[model samples]
Structure formats: C-alpha cells, structure tokens
Target: MVEPVADQVLRAIDQVRERYYRLIVIVGPAGSGKTSALQAVSALTSAPMINVNLELSRRLLNLTERQRAIHLPRILGDIVQETAAELVLLDNIELLFDVHLHVDPLRLLQRLARNRTVVATWNGTVGPNGLTYAVPGHPEYRRYPTGDLVIVEAKP
Candidate 1:
C-alpha cells in the first residue's frame, strides 16, 4: 500500500532537503527502498550520510538506555558535521530498542528531527493509523505512514 514514489514523494523530498524540514521519516521495511531513496536524495542534494550499523553488540535501535551513552551522540553529531550533511539517513532502525521493552526511538528521533532531515529503515507492517509495526502484535509507530514503511506484503 505504500504510495508510489511519484512526483508527490519527490516533492516532499525536495521540501525537506531544499527547505530544511527537520524530520524526514522514511519508514519502510527492509527492501522498501528507504535506504536507496535516501541515498538517491543525498546524492542529488548536498546532504551528508550517517549510517550507523546498530548490529554492533545490541539488537536495538533506540539511542537511550544504551550503556554506550556519551560517545554515540558525539559520534552521530560528528558524522553529521563530517559530511556537512544537512540530511541524516539511518538504516536498520528496527534495532533501535529501549529499556521500556518497547522500541524506543523517541530520543534519537526527536534529536535528529529537531534540526535535520532523517530517513530511517525498519522492519514491520503498516498499521491502521498510519503507524509502522515491527511485528503485528508489537507497538505501533505514528511517525510515518504504514504504506511508506512496508514495501510488500505476502498473504498467508
């Protein structure tokens, strides 16, 4: 149900990149072209890229509650400045976890959403209220549209 990446999407992309829209949530599944779309956008624009592979030791994507507190933010900020990137792109955001046992991407999301453009990749489905789900029973995300998060759905 993800709306095609037509002129509207392209325009949205331009609006965020050109005019500096704080948060650009690219909520989509593994192969939803979230990364690719961001890449293409970055390539075409002056945005820098910051791809943090959360596959290090933990399997979460939440920025808070992680024992590696101090350095991560510094590193993320550095990455942002390093690329002089106006747009920040995140991949495999499903790993963003929190102590609440629910995926807590708020801190990180809020941080980036504050002044930069962000597009994240996740694994889940589109829920009723334009939310993204890691699994059907898990928590839902209202940051982006469901279709935008899910690329395809295989019927059971």
Candidate 2:
C-alpha cells in the first residue's frame, strides 16, 4: 500500500526532530502538490507557517550587494527566530532562487536549524542524483549537497 504524502512528510519531520537536524526539503515538480502537503503538515503539527512571497521579498532582493550582505540574513533570520515552534513550515521558498539576490537560502535555513527544525517546500525534484532547482540549467540547480538534507519527494 502507498503511504499518503502527508504521512511521508510527517515521517521526515519526525526524523529531523529526532536527529536534531535542521532542514527537511519537500521537492517535486510544479502541480505535484508540494504546497498542499506542507499545509497539511502544518495543520497536524500546529507549527507556524511562513510563506516567502517573492514580490514581498523583492525589497530585500533589490538591495545592493553590500547592503543585502548586511541585512538579508537579518530579514530571513527574523522569520525563523520569531517562530517558537520546534518545527516551522516554510512555503513559497522559490524566491530564494532569484539569481539576482545573494541569499544563500539553504545555508540560512541550516543556520536556523541549529535552534529548530525547518520543513520547507521546494519547487523541484529529488532523485538518486540530487535536488534540482526549479529552472532547468539554472545556476541554483543541483547546487545543494544532499548528504545532510532530509529530502521528501512529493508524489502527485
């Protein structure tokens, strides 16, 4: 029997908490229900959900490299820090893929993980190879190391 996607995500969340890990990336192609799974997990866990809207984050994205270097971390850092829950649900993280911005999202998430677990929805695919970012051949594609990451592939 096939396990429900939410169950799979919940299992991964459990592992992250049990192992004291930081990040659980739910990867899948668009229309694969990644966001829905995140919502369901949030309901079950009662974790505060933060949705990173690209349009809203544009202000930070537009900052000069020098300014962003100093403030971007502070901005994203605040979201993770403000949530007291042990596990935070992060959705619409595609904003971090903007090549124009100098945000090292995965690194930021990992840093936050030191305090709590982060379950984020990633618009991509995870396979035997690795996580491939949204855009094909994009610079962010296949850039993250998967060894420490707990990746749950969202099934349609």
- Regions of model 1 farther than 4 Å from truth: 1-9, 14-21, 54-66, 69-75, 98-103, 136-156
Which candidate achieves the best lDDT against the true structure?
2
lDDT of each: 0.49, 0.76
- Cα displacement (angstroms), candidate 1, residue 67, comes to 2.6
Instruction: Report the C-alpha lDDT of model 2 over 1-156, residue by residue, as the tens digit.
Output: 977778898887777765655688888888888888888888888988888765337656677767765676677777677777778888888767666566777887677777788888888777666667755676765456688789888877
TM-score of every model versus the real structure? 0.59, 0.85
Q: Ten-residue segment with the worst summed lDDT in candidate 1?
A: 147-156
Model 2 regions lying over 4 Å from their true place = 18-20, 54-65
How many residue pairs clash in each candidate at the backbone level? 10, 0
